[model samples]
Every structure is written in C-alpha cells, then in structure tokens.
Target: MTTTRHPDARPSVSDPTGPPGAGRRVVAELLDLALLALPLTVGALLVDTLADADGGGQTDRVVFGGTAVLIALGILVWNRGHREGHTGASLGKHWTGLITRDRDTGHPVGTRRALLRRGTDVVTTRTAAHDHFTPLPPDTGVAALRRRRLLGLAALTVLLMLVLLASVAVGARPMSFAEVYHALIVNDGAETDIIVHSLRIPRTLLALLVGIALGVAGALIQGHTRNPLADAGLLGINAGAAFLVVLSIYLFGLSTPAQYLWFAFAGALTASVVVFGFASIGGGKSNPLSLALAGAAVAFFLQAMTQTIVLLDQTSLDGYRFWVVGSVAGRGMEVLWQVLPFLLAGTVVALASTPALNVLSLGEDVARSLGTNIVATRVVGIAALTVLTGAATAACGPIAFVGLIVPHIARAVTGPDYRWLVPYAGLLGGVLLVLADVVGRIVVRPGELQVGIVLALIGAPFFIALVRRRKLVSL
Candidate 1:
C-alpha cells in the first residue's frame, strides 16, 4: 500500500548531514571548553599584575583570583551550558560544523531537552549531533526600547545636575546647599558668594562645556572610525594642540590658557585636516583604517616636534606641563566664551550627522547600496569631531578618558544608535568629568589633583572591569 500525504505538508524528519563523528564531537567540546577558560586565565593574570603593583597582600590576591574564577565559571555555564543548550551550538560546535538536534523532529531540542540529551549521552557514552538549525526570533519592541533609553538619558541629565551642584559645593572652602543656592540666586557679596561665583562656578562651567565637547567628539570619532577605543587623540588633536601651545610659549612667551588658546585650537584643527587630507590622498576616499593610520603618523610627527620644543625651552616646558596636565580649574568664563561658537557649531553638525552615521555603521558596501554618501558622511563627522575636539582641547587641554570612556558608557545604555548615543555621551561625559573634578578636590584636600590625573586613576580600573565584564559593544 502506498502512503498518501498532503502537498502543503512538509517533511517531519530532516537531517542534511546526519550525526557528526565521535572525533568531531570530542574536538568541538574541547575547543568550546578552551575558549571558555581563556578569558578567565587572562583576567587572573592581569589582576595578579595589578595586585603586585599595588602591593596587595595575599588575601587581596586570593579574593581577586577567586572572583575571576567565579566569573569565568559563570561565563562557562552561560556559553557552554545554557546558551549552547538553547541554541544547539556552542562556538566550538559552530566552528566544527556540528549541532545538536532532536532525533525525531530534526530540530534543536529546546533547552531542557538538549540538556537531557547531553545527560543521556554522558550516561551512554554516545554522541548526538545534527545539522538542523532555526533562526533566532526577530527583535521587536524598538519603540519601547527607545523610550526606555530616553528615560535613561533624562536620568543621566538629573545626575549630571547633582554632580554640577557637587562640583560647586565641594571645593576647598566647602559650602552648604543653602549657601550655594543663595550665592547663585542671591548675591549678598559674602565669602561663599565670592567663592561660588568667582571660582567654583567658572571651573564647573568650564568642566561641563569641555566634558560635553570631548564626549560628543569622542562618539563621532568612534562612529567614523568604527573603533570603540578611538577618541579625539586618534586625529592628533592633543598632539597638535600641545605642539602649537609649546611653540607659542617658546616663540611668543604666552603663558596662560587664554593666551595659548588660539594656538591650541589652530593646531588641533590643522592636525585633523592633515589627517583627513592624508587619508583621502590615494583614492580620494577615506576609510576608518586609513584615517587611523594617517592620524597616528601625523600625531607622532607633531608630538616629536612638541617634545623637542619643550626640551629646548624651559618656559615652554613649564607652560606645556600645565596645559598638558588637563584641568578645568583656573579657567574663566572668558575661555568658555572663546570656544563656545566652535563647540555649538560642532555639536549641531554632530547631531545632524547621526542619521548618516547609523547608515554607515552597516559597513561601506551596505551603506553605499542604501544610497549613503560615504565621503560626505565622513567629512561631516570628521569636521564635527575636529571642531569639538579643537575647541575643548584649546579650552581645557585634552582631558583624557572623558572622550574615550563616556561614549562607551553611553553606548551601554543607548545601544548602537548614534542619535541617542551622542546626546547620552555628551551628558554622561559632563557628569563624569565634573564628578572626577569633585573627587580630585576631596581626595587631596587643600591641594587638588588635576582632572586628567583623577580620570586616569578612575578610568584605568573601570575600563579593565568593563572589558572583563563582557564583550565590547559592536561599533
């Protein structure tokens, strides 16, 4: 007797490649296990080095080592056990062309069934593998997700306001909240008013503007370069600014931030132009890799010139050291006013370019396919980046890590969408720098640490933890 089946019905059983061999299974499992172990081992070694540097005791070592081990185990369980059980393929299995599927239906056994199958395999000393696969569920709720991000941005804004208040209130001569409020709103000409209005207010405002500039510039640079680690420095902004500042000090005897601001701005702008020009030379098309390489070369050359100037002239060295240390202190509102136009222009352009950036993130081929003007997008991005970085560096020196760290933090909350990412980064950058400035004040008491130094101390460990916590977000 012949079996009858409906034309619309599909095959219930399908196995394109049949079961993978025992050798393949064993190799895949070993590969997966090794992959899981590698990060933990690296993290422990790094922690050990840091501990040794800090002169940590045995207990510290034990605690850190144990934490690393536990984190590793958690990852192992997620990657090898839960993720693989749910998805039917670990990294090893995927690499080795193996998958686990139900015997009857030729589909990935749901997580529990897959775990049960593994248990059965262990008991029977047998292997189960197939080539069947299913696509993951489509992403939805984008509107809700965006709304959540908006709320997060608002929360960050509020936090930044508190930090601003703290920056104003927590200086050498600490003032109460009431004093700070009165100083700002009611000018009674008191000592608190003098301190608040004259010193702390200017410094805080400078920090806020500079932080926003650096942060937004950083996000734009990273977006353009497609490098999460990239920042304004990649375009030689810092080096060029330093070079010109040094020159101005050596040649013109300019000693103050205000005196040297124009030189620094010019140098930063020139360096970025040079970078873009060099990147666009051969094919008239600038890619991320080319831009990065060009920027590095220009930066090195400028830095060499800067160092030579500083070494030759004592005055230059002193001035350069002060500028290079990166601080918002000792800057007046006049300095902020000087950079305000460039900063505003850069910010507007940066925001305008966000839509293009989103398209470009899809890679060049795809971007071109979708009618994105790659060169134009890059030019806008670089222009915005240069202007913002130039203005900020000129105003407050190149405050390290504000640019580098803020974008990543913002991205964590805002995802890869540049529209949200840029604004979030700007606000977060302001918050972080101002907060770091406050911490610097408190940590050293009478004499405060530079914002740059504080950022380095805080940023280093935070960055390490960020890396160890999970994979960097894809640019």
Candidate 2:
C-alpha cells in the first residue's frame, strides 16, 4: 500500500542532523549553569570581603546574603526563559553549534512557545526522549518585522526625549519645565539661567554624548566578537583608564578630569590592543571564546594593578575612588570638549563599519565569498571600539553596563541588522544613562548615588530579565 502525503506538510521533527548530542548538550548546560552562578558568586565574595574589612555584624551578612539570593534566583529564572524561549540556545548552545528551531518550518520557536515548550520539558524530564518541537506561526515576512521595529523605535525615541527633558528639569534644585525652557531661550541674569547653562545643560549633553559613544561601542564589540556579555569594561578599557588616571594623580597630582583625559585615552587604547593581541596569539583567527578569555585576563590584571597602586597611597585612593565609581556630575564643558572630537570620529567609524559587520555576521567564509575585506573590517571595528570606549571612559570614569545592557535592549527592538541596531542602541543608551542619573539624584535625597552605582542596581535585574526573555546566542 502506498502512503499519501500533502505537499505543504513537513515532519514535526527533522532527522536530528547537527542537533547537539546528549553529552554535548550536557556540557553546554553545565557551562550555562556556571555562567548563571557567576554573579552570585562574585556578589558573595564582595560581601565577604567588605564584611571582613569593616567587622560587620551577622545582621549585615544575613541581609546581604538574602538580597543576593533573591537577585540570583530572578536571574536564573529569567535566563532559563530566555535560553529556552527565544532562540532555543543559551551561551553554551551557541558555542556548541546547537539550535532549537521549529522542526517543520526550521524557524526559531520564539519566546512564548519556547516558554511553553520549556514547561513541558521540565514535567517530562524522567522520560527517555526529551526531544520536543514547538511549532512557529506562519512567517510574517521581513517587511512586517521592520515595520514593527520602526514603530517601537519611534516610541522609544519619544520616550527618550521626554526623559532628556526631565533630566534637564529635575536636579538638586528642581525647576519647572517652563523654567527650563525659559532659561534655555532667554538666558536672563536669573539664577535658573545660570544653573541651566553652567550645570544642567552641560551635564545632560555630556550624558547624551557618553551614552551614544558607549552604546555604539558596545554594539560594535558584541558584533565583532559575537559575545552577548562583551562590553568595554570587560575588554579592560575601564580598568586601563582607571589605572592611568590613578597614576597621573599619584605621580603628577593631576586632579581634574581634563588633566587626566589623555592618559585615560592612551591607557584604554593600549589595554585594548594588548587584549586583542593576546587573543590573537595562537589563532588561525581569534574566536569569541579566545577574545572573551583574553579580555577577562587583561581586565583582572589591570584592575589588580590599579588596586595595588591605590592601596599604597591614601591620597591617591581618596582621589581615585570617586572616579572609579563613575559619575557625570561635576563634569563641565571642558572635559566634554576634550572628548567630543574623538567621540564624533568613533561614531562615524562605527556607522560606516555597519555594512561590514552585517556581512561578517554571516560567518567569515561567507563574508569572504561575498567580497568582504575581513581583515580591514575588523581593524576598523577595533579602532572604533577603542576610540569610543576610551573617550567615554576618560570622560565618565567607566560607567558600567551602559555598553552591555543598552545593545541588548536595542537589538530586541531593531532585530539583527547592524544599521538599525547602532542607532537604536545609541538613543536607548542615552535614555538609560540620563534616566539613571536622574534616579540617582532622587533616590538618595539631598546626597546622590553615583550614576554608576545606580546603573548597576538597575541593570543587574534588567540583564537577568533580558537573558530570560530573549535568546542571546544567535548572530
């Protein structure tokens, strides 16, 4: 007897070709488990160190440990959702050449269905066969996705502008929106005008510039390295700058940001080159794992050196501590002026490198086949990354996670295209930093939380949520 089949029907599960075997999958899961535990481990270590130094009571330890545990649980759940939900691949999966896709359509299972699939998989874990497929809806086509992205971006843009305006209006000395507008336009001999011109406007502009720089730099770094966790700080840029800034203070008594700007820039560039050089040493071409490991090693070394220098000199430590925590406050037009040209140059380079990045995303062989100059493209990207991250770190003392978190947010809205990703990242980053700065001011009352501290507080949960909500392993 002959079997009949419909032309449109496809198998619910394909022949497991290229699917990671159980052992490989287990290894990948272990790797992901390690990554998930990393933050909690670091937090615990930090708490222990601080407690030991301060001779803290058990109450302090208990509170800190409890908080850390809650945060860790949230992160774990969110990451699990993201890995199993969106792309059906976690960090380990990406490294191991595993993918979760609809067996029939061969498309990603997507976030919602993926969550359902995960739930079912957890329940049926005792069974022999753990293989499962979540069907995807019919393709909506590229144009539809683009349209949705555009709409989302436009909304975010509007929201960002509102946040900017609010940043301009709210501070230690609050002003009405009308007052802010009046001060900007009129500039009479009023106190508000002085505050607006001399303090608020410059700070807000600096925030915008720094945000754009870090955001673009992050997108470039992630694209070039193909690592979701890659950031300027991770590459030792921040540690390098901080070390040089401390050295300048220790040696030459350079106190102001403007005085140490060049030192920071030079250090950042030098560190980036060293990291890349080390990563490239054994390579046919430096893969993401090599780059990430090299960066981590360099960052740790530089940070250790900086700590030693600071510990040896009390005066230098006092001066360096503030900058290390990262803030845009107290920065004037001079520091902004110093970093502006470099930031502009980096932005231009980043934008121009977008096409190359898009091609490179398709894998090196494919990019070369399509006539891409892979070497030149990487060089340009690294140059841009150095300049952008270096300038931003120089200006703002290494504000954490703007580079790491903003790009992921932008990517969610804009999809994988670098052209849209770059701009969206820039705009959203500006919003995030400015908003964070504003929150920092308000949260601690008359005294302010440093923007960096506030960002870490906010970004940690968001990062966990993002990991839970999206599939981060794909190109």
Best-matching candidate per TM-score: 1
Q: List model 1 lDDT by residue over 1-475, tens digit each.
A: 8987666665354523333568888888799778767767866774555343444334334434554676677666666666666666767877786666555554545555554564322111123423325623423488867787978978787778767766776666645557767898998999989998889999998888888888999999989998878888898989999999999999999999999999999999999999999999999899999999999999999999999998899989999999999998899988988999999899999999999999999999999999999999999899998999999999989788888898988887778999999999999888888888876775555578999999999888877876685666688
Candidate with the greatest lDDT versus the true structure: 1
Which residue pairs in candidate 1 have backbone atoms (N, alpha carbon, C) closer than 3 angstroms, thus clashing? none
Q: What lDDT would each prediction earn against the true structure?
A: 0.80, 0.78
Count of backbone clashes for each model?
Answer: 0, 2
Model 2 residue 105 CA deviation (Å) reads 27
TM-score of each: 0.71, 0.70
Error of 2 at 453 (Å): 0.9
